[model samples]
Target chain A: MNLSGETKLFLGVIIGTIAIIVLAAVIMSKPTPPAPAYTRNQLIPIGANTKGNASASAFLVEFSDFQCPSCKAFSSVVESLTEKYKDKLFFAYRHFPLDQHPFSRTAAAAAEAAGKQGKFFEAGTYFFANQTNFSDEFFAKAASVLALDATLYEKDRNSNDTKKKIDDDRFFSDTARLPGTPTFFLNGKQLILYDSSELVKAVDEAVK
Target chain B: MKEKFLNDQMTNRILFILSLLGVAIALYVTQSFLRKTPIVCLNSGCELVRKNPASYIAGIPVPAFGLIGYTLLVLLTFLRTTSTKLHKTLLPWIAGITGGGVLFVSWFTYTEAFVIGGFCTWCVISAGNMITMFSLSLYSHSHKK
Candidate 1:
């Protein structure tokens, strides 16, 4: 076939366009290793449930859902992260209850309620451990171990303030376009965790 | 063939370039979305638009449609520039395809702004790209020989 130079050039452009797009996509989509910890602790919102150092420049924030199994697995990692980095790193947890999990919203409220009584992480453990059995009954049993006043626990969990707090966190997740629960932000940078250990790596980098 | 197409091939050239740009932006958004990597937005809107149930139509990411639309526009514009015989025939196809592209952007932009309450900057760029290409095509179609 006798093709003009114009036709050949057009074909070249098309091929080049496709090739460039594919190349760029491959590069951008590569799972980013934990971003070098560039901590912006100010991004940690006021009133967020937090642990570890209050004034530390290095911090980690997580938006998690209690009924999520991956979140359950991750909570332990965060638990140890807080302990290991105590007096050095700050950690904050925010609710991002996905609708697919029936008990996610309730569990988030329960966590908030626990936060009021200085048992946020403890309540989180109970919810994550008893993920399958989430309900008022299970929460009441969990609250029993927290040594919280039963009446206050019940009242606090059901209070409007607790509901509003979860709603605010939910709104932030929606606004941030958080991909899903168990999403972590090291300092202010989002971590692309291909492995659970990335959290530790990220915190280590942040503190350094 | 119009003297305009022969002498002033500016729209054809520009449309091709704009459509190519659209392809790149749409490709990035589609892949970022598929990989579940958060797009860094000018504001927080990208996440809201991306993660919304509305972002997927029949399990297909919305930007995938933009990618297809832009790619088609690219091909048609390229064919028009290369083949004088096919030039007239390709103009209407370019216009029609871009018209559809505009409509697609309109729906998503509306949903993003009103329903989802946010919009991605890339989506905005794509919307402008389609609208500009469509306008240029309209000019090319109506410009007198």
Candidate 2:
């Protein structure tokens, strides 16, 4: 076949497209590398509600809302995962109350209030269990059920400090441009969970 | 006969360019859908479509199909330009490919309008591109003889 200038040019573009696509596929398919240490705490800042050893090399931070169905679904798994890696994992839960979930903000505040009383995770048990049943007085009932100080729970849950903490989590969520609820970061790398079991596998890997 | 050859060359060039444009549009849509990023569209239609389950088929983002189709067209158009023999062989394949593309895009457009109850600007632009390429395919087919 006799070669033409335009033909070569178009073929060049076609070849270029294929080359770029192959390069991209190769890059995207490789496992994500660990994030640098300095940027690690940017998402898991000080005073954030946390469990496990602060200095542990494996850190897991979750941006979640109590009223989110997916978050609730993953709550039990995370709880058990944390228990399994209690010594090795440093876990933090940030609140990202989507506007669609009307009670999520209040539930976040309630969780923080329980944090103040040192029963945040315990309160979480109730919150995740009764997501669909949240009412204005649900927080109070949960506090009562957990045997927390009723007066302090009411005062703290309604306090400006609790509001600020939840607001700060929201601010961080927006700053990170988090895609959706229950977004998890394991060892400073976001975990894309296709199934709940991925969490256990990832945490096991992280701790190891 | 020389004039006719030039016309076919011009038509193939036009098809190649259009296919290139389709690639760009499809690439953007595919990336946006995969990354869950909001797309540039009028009246938030892009976000609506992005969130809708219909934007995917069998868990594969819809724009991926467009990307493959357009990229294949790009290759075919360039091959047709190499020689008259190749053009004769490739022109009917181009027509068939674009004909299938038009049908698929039309179905997607209909799903967007009626089933999804919204429109993505990229999807609409892709539909237009597919239709135009199909029209060019028919034009070249008629002129082939």
Candidate 3:
């Protein structure tokens, strides 16, 4: 069967035309979605150890791991801001121990155990500031140092209360679709702070 | 028709098939974006690379670029007239660029799986497609007398 030259040329044009149409359709179909409505108070969450009104106009929630360096730095910023804003802001701390970090969850549970004695934030801040002290002895010693009720701390440390808190915090992390630790939620919306300046800007706006 | 058979009929058919699959995957991602579903990548490297905003150039996804490249290859394969030596010469160049892009994406995927801890399904599929296209292009073009 002798295939004519013209027939081959025709085939090329037809298939080429189809490919172009498909590519163009794909390119044109996806347009980036518009940015969500945002405000300052709706951007950063209040964390545990924070002393403030829950009914405050703005709330900040921090999802963090004790072993993370960035979480420690971010924690410091939050602490200063908390002091700066004192009465006007609300803060909450949620634990999100990433799978790669071995000691984060144990530290989180230990902190929750402290929470039962009204020292949750104190223990958590201590853990972040001194992450190298993640050994069982170190954590137990921190509990003793904070003067928590030893019996209750030990019970809650190994109890459902600790696991549930960790699990509950994980739920928010998943909801925010966080890719890494130190994820912050201002109000209930995901807060992406690319830099410290952005974070400060967010807090300033929230206070406004 | 010998020229047409060589450039369009045989080679173009495979390009068209591969390109269609690439387009289908691209469309699926678009739909996922529109529906606000998480861009799930079971491949660790794929997920890590995708998770990084730095992976995109000017907000355009790397896979989207792959989609355009595959589509262009398909067009070049099917639209080139057999008698034109220019189209014949261009085939390998198109395949080389496609192979290079795949190579870059593959390195990132490797880092994700071995170094990082996640996977991306679409990236793996696209890499496979590029490898297949490169093989086919070489096989078809080399056999031409």
Alpha-carbon RMSD of each model: 12.3, 8.9, 8.1
Off-target runs (Cα >4 Å) in candidate 2 are A1-38, B1-145
Across A143-175, the per-residue lDDT of candidate 1 in tens digits comes to 777888878888998999889888988897887
Q: Per-chain TM-score of chain B, candidate 1?
A: 0.92
Q: Judged by DockQ relative to the true structure, which candidate is superior, 1 or 3?
A: 3
TM-score ranking from best to worst? Answer: 3, 1, 2
lDDT of 2 by residue, A138-180 (tens): 8768787888888999999999988988888899778776667
Off by over 4 Å in 3: A1-57, A63-90, A95-157, A167-184, A188-201, B1-14, B26-37, B43-53, B58-60, B80-90, B106-121
Give DockQ for candidates 1 onward, in order.
Answer: 0.09, 0.15, 0.10
Question: Which window of 10 residues has the lowest lDDT sum in candidate 1 chain B?
Answer: B1-10
Q: For candidate 1, what is the DockQ-based docking class?
A: incorrect
Task: Answer with 1 or 2, whichever has the higher TM-score.
Answer: 1
True contacts reproduced, candidate 2? 0.19
Clashing residue pairs in candidate 2 are none
Real A-B contacts recovered, model 3: 0.03
Instruction: List model 3 lDDT by residue over A1-208, tens digit each.
Output: 5545754665665677568767977886687554353443433333344456766887776778887655765777888877787677777777788776688888888888888788887887788778755787887777678898888888888898578768777775766567566766666656655434456689778878
- Chain A TM-scores for all candidates read 0.79, 0.80, 0.75
